[model samples]
Target: MRGWGDIPHFIHQSAGTLRNGPLVQFLNNIDITIMNKPADYSASEMKQISKRYTTVANQINRHRTNELKNQTIIFNLSESFANPNRVPGVKLKNNPIPNIEKIKKRTTSGIMLSSGYGGGTANIEYMALTGFAMCNFAQTLSTPYTQLVPYLRHNPSIIQSFNYAIAIHPYSSKFYDRGIDYPKFGFNKFFYLGNKKAPIIHQKKIGANSYLSDETAYDNTLNQLSRHPQGQFINLITMQNHLPYNHLYHHISHYKATVPANGTIAAQVENYAMGIHYTDQAVAKFIKEIDNIDRPITLVFYGDHLPGIYRNSMKKDGLKLHETDYFIYSNPAAQRLGAKNLTKHNHYVGPNDFIAMTA
Candidate 1:
């Protein structure tokens, strides 16, 4: 099978009856082992891979980490966040994300080359946490969270460097097999909507029919931060700006989009923009809340991917559609501790570069 999406059809066609539970389970295991088998590399290819890693190791060794010794790091992955202006023939009456735009001016900010366009949120998160580029993997190795992470014996990640690290997502933990995969990545705790150990403390949804707002996501993050006095690494994924952009918000932003499509797409675009606006305001508030804390703190914020809502614009924008916003900001406390020069301005980088850049 090409990817996880093909498994259902494969099972339907090959497995005649679902009544034989043991037989089905046996076949499933065989299929998984075959699909996720590691590639056989020649001696030359192995040499090249070793050389690449050695070079990376040398580059990392050259950097000084004294500035970051006392800083708490937070990775904020925003859902379906994109620059609306990237869409062709689209015109915004006003900027939907003024706060982020302003913050980008003075910090290490740039456009990240996202691996997926409309979806595949997990892949981006995987790269950010692991510092491994998806482009190096075989094309069939799609949706690694389901196809690969479970079978692996060890999954190395940035979380391993921290004594206290947690992941928080304001949605169901079951998505992308994260419920099974997070432990392998070495997260101390994973918080989500239905997690029994650390259930989501802030579950306030936005609009009449929408996912939880970023404000509540930040509240939960702050609660987690407060518990860890020394320091912590937080991976927060916000769901307020997620899909089904069909008038979820009561009042859409005034920033109008003029896609060369029907009214339905336009309405969706506007609603998505409104969600971005909310995130912008919520992020400003979050940054302010953390600024007063005495300890050093650094936040790495970025959009996962553009919303799949733009069918016509996706084709027109091409590679531009794959570029989303990213920025790294250290608060006053971190700056006071010689953290001002930790990150430099980068115009373009891949999602895999985030962990390396921050380190």
Candidate 2:
């Protein structure tokens, strides 16, 4: 848990274009199919279908809005960004330990910041985020023993070792298409200008390196991170909740049931809930791993933003969108050792406020 301000020195770069990519194309198709139905359809039929879709969409949007609003409030309350006088809690061996000075000193020491849109944002956004985090962390640490290089070259082992060492979980890869660059170590960088519609591309993927899986891509990242043993903090961004609702839903159907009315709003809500449930399961696994770690570790897990499904629902329900929701769970080992029950910290907090709360 290095202090956010003390992160190591690192350069931040972005690549690729935002528009006309596979994701944008797919989203456009979905929008057209839903919003541009033939005008010739019977008014009664249209009314029935619209009512259902709108209902579901509205419910989702309301949920998202509420979540956003909550996050905003929490962010406002954080001392890290707003109030410097407020000290973050430090729990060692699970007790309400008063080492605020030590925590603050350790946090601000040698931290680096390399932020970009894609990787921190979602799966398709991975190319930018993962590459940047890895490169920056690597540059900071002295290299590990040279003998480990050969084992690191093995793709599967490389991926697993890197992730495990950094405490990054496997399911985090859902936000981006991993393995877009295999064999080679690079990211599928995408860029979008602030005022312009198109992207400025420099390097693009070619040859057999194009077909990488999310799992493998993550593995590659872990491999890269593992090269630096001196780098104490490795912050990872995951994309397990990115869109194409139906596709994401499929993976967690076991936790969900068919909607009663088939194409009705209630059904859509149920499906969305099911997807969230699956994400929860993934989070649970991460928590379990943290709890089992032999050394002291602080795990901070939270959503970057609420899912788009919830945004759509807000429109249908006519609710004003507001805050985002986040939760911070400590390792069970910390609890066992006398850590305060920080689970009660489950409240709406913005992304920026996270460092303050956990600092």
Candidate 3:
């Protein structure tokens, strides 16, 4: 987990945009390179590599049994949705995410060990979609969407199992080069703010919040779902709970910290909690709506990473800071179709394992 402030440096050195330019030639001569070296393998070795990846892709494609083919799978990549109690010496007056807590008790829920602590959102998204871990990549490969996706010939992803696959993010599509990379990942369309193919249908936001609310995200998702009679795969990355948490909610819950902290950090935590509180309400409502639908549907919801607001408690929390809440929930209609069998009972997992665990 590196600071996002250093993204420009990573991009300048690793992005494929420099390909076929003098800069690349200069870097190559100096023993520095961004583009991956062409595979140095004999015909037999190439055949083996091809076979390995093909086997993995085939396994994933065949994992979704016929009974589960009609089930719509929605992956909700919630932003900065972490448990406040996990932070040392911090306590809230009331449970901020009671709805999520209740759902976790009944559903296949657990902790997801995230790749990034504060801001590696795209990497987690990549892991969930492609079933590839960031840890397996070179340490210099910080943002694969820019550094790797452009150069890859094929992208085998969970989306291949569905007839229709779309991505919904209530923010800029250009971030992390998603607009350019989504098609490569088998997505049919991307719905984001001002997207030309399919614009974001819902744009409602919370009080003083710069990002759209989870309610609106769900609304837009539901709208998209209504149009596709065939089961669809939706990758929804929410933005409501993103950074700059300053007193965004009308009703701010007071969080009493045993260890003294600055006023700004305290307010950020309170505002972030309130944000998740709204997400809880929205999630409960969304599930209720899914329950009433005739079609089978399953939602995989989890936070991308913990917010950067807890600088004070980072060292104390350690790896706990990289763990966020997640659950694999099937609607009653899907449960009746044995969608419940798709998930394993394991209580802890990594984002890279989600495709295999759920499919």
Q: How well does each candidate superpose onto the true structure, as a TM-score?
A: 0.84, 0.35, 0.84
Tens-digit per-residue lDDT, 1-359, candidate 1 = 33532233121212422433445534544444324345785788889999999998779768655534346999999997888887666667788999999999888888988988788899999999989888767665666776678778998888877887889998887778788888888788999988888999867877765688999899999898788867778999999988888868765658676776533377888888888998999999999989988888889999999888766545656788798999988889888766554344478888888887776
Q: After superposition, how far is residue 246 of candidate 3 from its true place, in Å?
A: 1.2
The clash numbers for all candidates, in the given order, read 0, 37, 0
Global CA lDDT of candidate 2, please?
A: 0.30
Task: Kindly report which residue stretches of model 3 are placed more than 4 angstroms away from their true locations once superposed.
Answer: 1-69, 254-264, 313-315, 341-345
Span of 10 residues, lowest total lDDT, candidate 3: 1-10
Q: Which ten residues in a row have the lowest lDDT in candidate 1?
A: 5-14
Off by over 4 Å in 1: 1-69, 262-264, 313-316, 341-345
lDDT of 1 at 190: 95
Winner by lDDT between candidate 2 and candidate 1: 1
Q: For model 3, how does the per-residue alpha-carbon lDDT over 1-359 read when each residue is reduced to its tens digit?
A: 12422223333333433543545433433432334555675788889999999999788768556544467999999988888777665667778889999999888888988878778888899899999887767665677876778668898888888878999998987788888889898889999998777998767988999898999999988888788867889999999998887768866745433334633366777788888889999999999988888888989999989988776555666777787999889888788777664345567888987887776
Please state the error at residue 87 of candidate 3 in Å.
Answer: 1.6
